[model samples]
Target: MEEAKGFVRRVLLLKFKAETAPNHVERLIKDYSNLVNLVESLKTWHMGKDANIKNLHEGFTHVVELTFEDDEGEAAYSAHPAHLEFHERAWPHVKKMVVIDYKPTSFHT
Candidate 1:
């Protein structure tokens, strides 16, 4: 059998302030998605809004998932100028956010 590979996955859960306008959220999504082009370490990026079907989101309404080859790649992306700019523009409107990073693992029995 082929060996399982490992990569870093960064998950960002965002909860916008109750009063944040829809347009701002849209703009943020566009800006966040654009980071993939500017940050070479980003191997993949995806974003979505909570469906609210199970009502388990708590207050986080939006999610951003980013894949990197390793933790160093993620660190480079975090320190990149484009990310800093985006963070400054986006944080004021955000009520709270949770960020988690982990190495994907696969197991077979």
Candidate 2:
């Protein structure tokens, strides 16, 4: 496979625990939306509750899409203190999560 030599993306799928409160879920989404201001390398951000056919989602309830300039931007966002704090706020409510980082070739989502 050829190397991807362009922008990078971080995609996250979240499933909140059954007992988590609704308000906390709301806050989690807000936190994600705010990262653009706190992290300079964050070029774009989009997050929302899963609206797909309920049966298809299994337990995942939220999807977050983040774009970075490059691998360095991705690394910078990962280690940023604000990002760590955000994780703390969301992790308590998250039952399971899937994270994928890749460079988009034909990607024009």
Best by lDDT: 1
Instruction: Report how far residue 59 has shifted in candidate 1, in Å.
Output: 1.5
- The Cα error of candidate 1 at residue 37, in Å, is 0.3
Question: TM-scores, in order shown?
Answer: 0.91, 0.88
Candidate 2, pairs of clashing residues:
none
- Among the numbered candidates, top TM-score falls to 1
Q: 42 in model 1: Cα distance from truth in Å? A: 0.8
TM-score quality measure for candidate 1: 0.91
Each model's RMSD to truth, in Å?
2.2, 2.8
Q: After superposition, how far is residue 57 of candidate 2 from its true place, in Å?
A: 0.5
Q: Residue 84 in model 1: shift from native, Å? A: 0.3
